[model samples]
Target: MDTTMGASRRRGRLAAVATVVTAAAFTTALTGCGSVDKTLDCVQTADTIADSVTDLQQAVEDAAHDPGRADAALDSIETQLRRIGDKTDSTDVNQAVDDLDRAVGRVRTALRNGDRTPDVGPVTDAAGELTKVCTT
Candidate 1:
C-alpha cells in the first residue's frame, strides 16, 4: 500500500509539473512575437515601401540629372521590401514581395530607357500596383 501511494504521489507531481510547463510555454507563445506584432510590422513595412516608391517617383521627376537620387530611392525600397519578406511568415506576404519585385524591375527599366519623355506610364503603373499590394 505504501509503495502504491508513493507511486501515486510521484505521478501527481509529474502531472502538475507538466501542466505548469505547458501553460508557461503557451503563454510565452501567445505573448511573445505573436501575430499582432507581426501584423503591425507588416503594415509598417508596407507603408514604408509605398512611401519609398513615391519618393522615387518624385526624385525621378525632380532630379533627373542625378542618378544617385534614383539609386537611393531604389535602395530604400529594396530594404523595406526585404524587411517585409523576412517578417511576413505568410503566403500573402510572400506574394506581396514578389509583386513588389516585379514593380521595382519595371521602374528600373523605365528609368534606364533614358528618353527625356520616356514612358513613365509603366513606372507609375508599377508603383500604384505595389502600393495596392502593400496596403492589402
Candidate 2:
C-alpha cells in the first residue's frame, strides 16, 4: 500500500510540472506574436482616420446646400482628429493629423464667412498621407 501511495505522489508531482511547463510555453508563444496586436491597432486607427476624412468630405459637399450641417460635421471632424493626435505616438501620424487639422480649420473659416467654395485639396492630401502611413 505504501509503495502504491508513493507512486501516486510521484505521478501527481509530474502532472503539476507538466501543467506549469505548458502554461509557460503558451505564454511565450503569445508574447512572441505581440506584433500582431500592434498591427491590428494600426489598421484600426487608420480605418478610423479614413472614415473621418470621408465624413468631412461629404460634409464639405453638403455645405453648399446646408452650411449648418457642414459646420457641425467640421466640429466633429476636429474632435476626432484631436483624439487621434492625442493617441498616436508616431511623428508621421502626428504631422498628418496636424495637416488635416489645419485644412479643417480653413474650411471652417470659409464656411463661417459663407464662402461655400472652400478648397478641399489639402484635407484630401493629408488624409491620403495618413492612410499611407497606416497601411505601411
Candidate 3:
C-alpha cells in the first residue's frame, strides 16, 4: 500500500510538470506568431508603396503625352496612397501619403480643366519624397 501511494504521487507530479511546460511552449508560439504577422504586414505595405510609385511614374509619362490619362492616374494614385496610409502604422508614411494625395488632387484638377501649363513640380516632389520613404 505504501509503495502504491508513492508511485501515485510521483505520477501526479510528473503530469503537473508536463502541463506547465506545454503551456509555456504554447504561449511562446503565440508570441512568435504575432511577430511574424507584424513582419508580413510591413512587407505588404512596402510592396504596395513600391507598386504605386511604379504606376505613378508611368502615369506621369502618359500624362505628358495624353493629358486625358492624368485623371485616371490621379484617381488611382489617391486610392493607392489612401490604402497605403491605412495599412501602415507609421506616422511618417501616413503624412507623406497625405501630402502626395493633396498634390495629386491639384494635378488632377489642373488636368481636368484642360490646363496645358499645369505645374507638376509639386506632384513630382511629393512622389520623390514618398519613394524615398518607402525605399528606406
Candidate 4:
C-alpha cells in the first residue's frame, strides 16, 4: 500500500511538470507569431507604399496635364503610412515611417507652392528605407 501511494504522487508531479512545459511552449509560440504577424503587416504595407510611390512618379510627370493625379497618389501613400503606423510598435519601423511622411510632406509643399515637377527623389529614397526596415 505504501509503494502504490508513492508511485501515484510521482505520477501527479510528472503530469504537472508536463502541463507547465506545454503551456510555456504554447506561450512562446504565440509570442513568435505576434512578431511574424507584425513583419507581414509591415512588408505588405511597404509594398503598397512602393506602388503609390510609382504612381506619384508618374503623376509628377503628368502633372501639367492632370494636377489632381499627384494629390491622389500622395493621399494613397499617406493612408498606407497611417495603416503601418497603427499596426507597428517597432522603433525602426516608426522611424522609417516618419521619414517617409516628412518626404511626402516636402513634395506636397512643393506642389502647393506651384512647383509642377517637384523633386520626388527624397520620397523614393525614404520609401526604400521603409522597405528595408520592414524586411529586416
Top candidate on TM-score is: 4
- Per-residue error for 37 in candidate 4, Å, reads 1.0
Please give each candidate's TM-score.
0.60, 0.63, 0.53, 0.76
User: Among all windows of ten consecutive residues in candidate 3, which has the lowest summed lDDT?
Assistant: 13-22
By lDDT: ranked, best first: 4, 2, 1, 3
lDDT of 3 by residue, 20-107 (tens): 4344444444656764454344334434444454444455555668665556656666776766677777676667778878887787
Candidate 4 yields a Cα-based lDDT of 0.78
Residue 46 lDDT, candidate 4, scale 0-100:
77
Q: Give one digit per residue, the lDDT tens place, for model 2 in 1-136.
A: 4745644554454344334434444444465455544434544554555555555555666666766776766676677677667766778778877887898889888777878757655665665565555444
lDDT of 4 by residue, 1-136 (tens): 4745644554454344334434444444465676767776677677778778878877887799999999999999999999999999989999999999999999999999999988777787787777777766
The whole-model lDDT of each prediction reads: 0.57, 0.60, 0.56, 0.78
What is the C-alpha lDDT profile of model 1 across 3-102, one tens digit per residue?
A: 4564455445434433443444444446646665665566556556556655665566565577667768778888887887877667866776777677
Model 4 CA lDDT for position 106: 96
What are the C-alpha RMSDs, in order, of all predicted structures?
A: 23.9, 22.9, 24.6, 22.9
Candidate scoring better on TM-score of 2 and 4: 4
- lDDT score of model 2? 0.60
